[model samples]
Target: MATDSIGNVELTDSTPTDATAFLIEPPRKRTKTTSGRRSRTNFEMLAWLFMRLSGIVLVFLVLGHLIIQLVLDGGVSKISFAFVAGRWASPFWQAWDLLMLWLAMLHGANGMRTVINDYAERPGTRFWLKVLLVAATVFTVLLGTLVIFTFDPNIS
Candidate 1:
């Protein structure tokens, strides 16, 4: 058994034959992290489902937003603060923007988390990356929601 520089874990070349290489087999059943015990929660499955559902919803939301904001406006020059204020004055439009804001932020954050998990080999690096991701996601969501709901139109 060879150990890494950390001198804690005993690395071995042997791995379970059941865990065939990627693409050759479906994903192996997930177990408890590092403990070899079975995990009770299906967090990963829920996240995967969220990604798929949100992606579909986002496609429609983004397309509709684009059509209304850009193409129907006859280009970017037509968009103005007055136009946005008028749109947001309606509760329905406010809700629509809020939903889009939340879904897009969460969808992007989850994808980034997956990327960090896959690429960040070091535990410390992965942890910090996710912490930053969560912080940024929360900050953006809060800021965006605040801007949408508390928009003050009187500012000259």
Candidate 2:
């Protein structure tokens, strides 16, 4: 029994004395469940790995892009339509842009999905939020990819 400062509140420490309570349980270790036992896939693990790898790749891609577009040569003033056309004309630049677009979009969308899953209390809310996130990501990726591949320097 104990008394608090607020008032004379009685307290009882009723700790469990069963064998189970006294037994030292080992920390939980995750084992890969057989497909027959569980249908859960390794999606979370893969998503975590993707986040790390994409972050590293994005550092290089985004830094290079910023340096080229905003810092090198005459800086932002030199980034004219013709400048963009010239850069996109090269296959290497095109591929770089495409990879950057895909990785950035996917990484951002995955991050949003994780946020939604963690914060959204309702299952329906989570599902719809993820759907919207995925739809927007897919749309943006497709549009960016189309523009990158189908860009015409001759457009007046």
Candidate 3:
């Protein structure tokens, strides 16, 4: 028992269970206010759609490519620098390779971006991870395009 400066009576430690109940309890959940503007747009919807579309196209492109490369004729042993040169001389193979490269790269980059967004919790961490991902994707795309377009057979 205690008394304030005004001499009002007060109780101390009278309800020990109440005090202990709070000590062992979990915190209350936070409620976000939805009365404001809309939340940020979910880019995941586009990414999910892209994955499905790209996967279907890639299946066709990759299967056709493999059949032509492996099942048509002499297969791996028949492939050489001359074979590559002959193939690249045609616009058909060049276009096929270009499409495969672009689609696969875009699909893989978008997948990795989703992964980064899911795992990287911190703002700085997510930003830097996406930055690195973009850098790698750009470098690979550019280098692959250059190689596909400028492959020289006459080089010694």
Cα lDDT of model 1 by residue, 4-101, tens digit: 79876664544555684558656565546657766789988999999999999999999999889888857777899998888998999899899999
- In order, what is each prediction's RMSD in angstroms? 12.0, 9.7, 5.2
Report every candidate's CA lDDT.
Answer: 0.89, 0.90, 0.86
User: Where's the lowest-lDDT run of ten residues in candidate 1?
Assistant: 9-18
Name the 10 consecutive residues with the lowest summed lDDT in model 3. 27-36
Clashes (N, CA, C under 3 Å) per candidate:
0, 0, 0
Model 3 has a clash total of 0
Candidate number of the best lDDT: 2
Q: Give the alpha carbon lDDT tens digit for every residue of 36-88 in model 3.
A: 56568777687799899999999999999888888788787788899888999
Identify the candidate with maximal TM-score: 1
lDDT of each residue in 70-145, candidate 2, tens digit only = 9999899998899999999999999999999999999999999989988997779999998899899999999999
User: What C-alpha root-mean-square deviation, in Å, does candidate 3 show against the real structure?
Assistant: 5.2
